[model samples]
Target: MNVAVIGGGGREHALARKLAQSDRIETVYAIPGNDGMRDVAEVVPEIGETDFEKIAALCTSKQVAWVVVGPEAPLSEGIADYLEGRGIKVFGPRKEEAKIESSKAFTKDIMEKYDIPTARYKAFTDYDAAYSYIESVGAPIVLKKDGLAAGKGVIVATDMDEALAGLDALMADSDAPIVIEEFLEGEEFSLMVLVNGDYTHSFEIIAQDHKRAFDNDEGPNTGGMGAYAPVRHIPESVRQEAVDQIVGPMARAMVSEGLDYFGVLYLGAIVTDKGVKTIEFNARFGDPEAQILLSLMEDDLVDVLEKVDRKEAFTLTFSPRYQVGVMLASAGYPGSYDKGHTIDFEAVREKSFVSGLKQENEGWVTAGGRVLLVTGEGETIESAIDSAYHNVDQVKFNEGEVFIRRDIGRHALK
Candidate 1:
């Protein structure tokens, strides 16, 4: 079977790599794929991910059996619905179901209606009204844009001045409503579940993502700095509680709300002293999180997604070894930075996933904020982390300094 994977990031690259491993799949094509994916999947550099007409034509021409979407933007824009309307098989949620990730206000309303555990939040359209709400709530607040902000739209402020400035910064250039939420203090973890509009569908192994750009969780938030699987910080009891009180309820609630959600549901939650509460929800597998999570999977990824598409019975299995993925970024990332730096892929020792590299006359150059993700697996978390960073240290970006967090998986190791 020939499958076409959408988007051209680390997540999409990881998905393409995993799906290509399936013996059931004969070919895999990546739309606008990066330079590294040429090794495993055929690269189609002409069509854009959001080019619905072009994508449909490609599927028809290639006799593509299944179309797997990797990014959230195309899903929220109703690409799956468009393709399915033309009788094309897609493994993603419809537009209405994608509201769970597209609109923060909509997600908060759903949580409130279903009595799910979450933080106190208020949506505002007027600047004065939003400022008044912030004053009432005091410092250490979270300001989020109502629509998609690429994961950096959220601003965590420490004081009223910073809060107001953050809100102003978000409101300065856009008219979209902003959601002011009370900050939840706890350890954060990522729980990604596969579903076919069924509340009883099982979830994959729990993983944790480090969103902050630098080590010790002290820096601006980027797409993702690093990630690891089988998070030990989240106890078994808390994990079960999250599945019961959070993931299960949300899945059923989507059905009740008349939304057929059929894809990966990512639950970004925090284990507070009081209990487990949701921090945010993503409509698909996370970037660096997908890197380590998919690395540990023992089951064929294409078969799993196909089963979800067919609503057939299939279970997800994982290796017991701990997996760690550390991201290598261009200097001054999560901020303004330079690109087109030459990168040495030959120095890399183990499996490494490329994100922002394109072939140039000289060599592969850094083309995005996050350059690559080097992953390693071992019997112990400490050994995995050690191996991951050791391989990361081998790669070099000649034009500028490459920054990486040395403390990835440290919290779990401790």
Candidate 2:
């Protein structure tokens, strides 16, 4: 069987590698796949991920048995519906369901209606009203763009000036509604659940991503700097509380509303004083988190997806070792950065997943903000973190136009 994965990033790279591990899978095709995926998948650079018509054509031509949507943008645009209309099976949710991630207001309403634990928030389209509300609420408030901003739309303004500036910038960027809410203090973690609108499964392991671009959790938020799985400090009881209160209720509520939901449900939640409350919801897998979590999986990813699609219970397995992954980004990432600096991946090619690369006769060069993710595993999170950084040290970027956060797994520091 052949499978096609949509998206050209480190997350898709991890999905391709795992999908290729399935015995039933004959070939894995990465739609507009990056150069790093060539070893694991047939790169189809002629087509773009969000081009629904061309994606259907490629699926038909390649005889792709199943298509896994790796990113939220294509899913939000109803790639699942388009592909399914042409007799192809998709692993992501439909258009309406994808609104959970595409539009912050959509998910906020559902959370309020379902009595799910989340932050106290209000949505606004008028710029004046949003700014007024921010002033009324005061500082240490959270501001989010109603639509997708590649995970960087949120601003945790600490002062009144910062809040007003963030609101201005957000209002200027898009005409969409702005979400402002009271900041909830707690530790944040990523919980990615697999659901088919009926059955939902929460993994025993949970991963936490460092969103800030620099060490000590300072600097602006990037997509994700790094991540580690099986957050031992979180405790099993807290995870269960999250599933019972947030993940399970939301899935059932969507079903109650007659929305056909499927695929991964990424919960960006915080363990606050009031318990687990959702910060945001993403329709697909998290980037660096997927890189680490997928590595620990002992089961075939295809089988898991099939079971979820069938709405049957699945008992998945995992490696006992803790997994860690750190992203190597082009300098000045999560902002403006230089690219086309030559780099090498041969040393860590097997164990690392490369992204944002432009192949040339000389070698591959940096092509995107996040260049690649280097992962490592160990019996302990500390060792796992060490191993990942050790591999990262060997990689050399021409002109040294690269930046990496050193304290990726600091929370697990003993």
Candidate 3:
């Protein structure tokens, strides 16, 4: 089968690599793909994700059997709906279901309506009203922008003063609406599920991403610093509860609301003393998490995605091994930074054994603002982190342009 993956990030590169290894796949194509994907698939340059008509035409012409939407922006723009409406098979949720990630206020409202476990939040379009609410709520609040702000929309304020500043920044200067939520204290985890409206299959629960730019959980938030699978922090009982109370309920609620959500349902969850509560919902896969999950997935990528797109029931087997992924970004990332910086991967690959799997050097190249994802798999999370960091240390870029978190799997270590 011929498959096409949309987006130009490390996540898409990982997906392309996995699909290329499938025995049943004849060819894989990536639209506007990065340099890393060149070794695994044919990179098409003309069809931008937002240009639906052009992309659809390319798919038809290329005889692409399946289309995988990678990023949230295009999915939120309804690319899946447009493709499916044209009788094309696509692995992504429709635009209506995508509101769960695109609009924070809408997601909070839906959670309240369906009784989904989540942090208490109040929405405001008026700046003064939101400021007043923040004062009442007091310090240590979570401020979120209603519209998409890349991954920096949500802010965890340390005090009332910081909370007010965040509100003003999001509502006053920015045209986007703001959502001020009660800050919930807990360790976080990421849960990804495959949903076909009526049926859903969950992957192994993994530790949450380190969104901050530096190590020791300090500094401003970036898209993500790194992540690992099979988080030891979450007990089996807690994971089961999350599946039952969070993932399953959210899937059912979306189906009941007349939205036939098909494809990946990414949930950002907090394991609070009161049980698990959802921090946010994403219609597609998570970045660094996706990299680690795909590394540990033993099933054929084509088979799993096709089943979901066809709305057929299926199960996936995961390797017992743990996987860790470390992201290397340009220094000023999550802010303004230089692009097109040259990277050297030869020294990086020699640092560790990554699952004992070897690949051609053509796969190593700078793809996005966040350039490379150094991953490792081991029998335990400790070994995985050790292996991943070993490889991450060897990579080099322009001076003062490389930034990554050093404590990707520390929670699991504890």
Question: What digit string (tens of lDDT, one per residue) describes model 2 on residues 1-414?
Answer: 999999999999999999998889999999988888888899899899899999998899889999999988899999999999999999999899999999999899999999999999999999888878887889999899998888899998888988898999889978899999889999999988999876899887899999998999888878898999889898888899999999999999999888988899999989988888999999999988988888889999999988888888777788989888888899888889988888886787787887678788869888999988888788998889889888888887754598888888889874
All candidates' TM-scores? Answer: 0.97, 0.98, 0.93
Ranking by TM-score: 2, 1, 3
RMSD per prediction, one decimal? 1.5, 1.1, 3.5
* CA RMSD (A), model 2: 1.1
After superposition, candidate 2 runs with Cα above 4 Å error: 398-400
> What C-alpha lDDT do the candidate models reach, one value each?
0.86, 0.89, 0.79
lDDT of 1 at 268: 92
What does candidate 3's lDDT look like per residue over 282-397, in tens digits?
Answer: 88888878877887788998878767666676667778888888878776777777655556666755222121111235433333456677887789888888888888767665
lDDT score, candidate 1: 0.86
Candidate 3 TM-score to native = 0.93
Residue 154 of model 3: what lDDT? 76
Over 151-177, each residue of candidate 1 has an lDDT whose tens digit, in order, gives 788888988998999998989989988
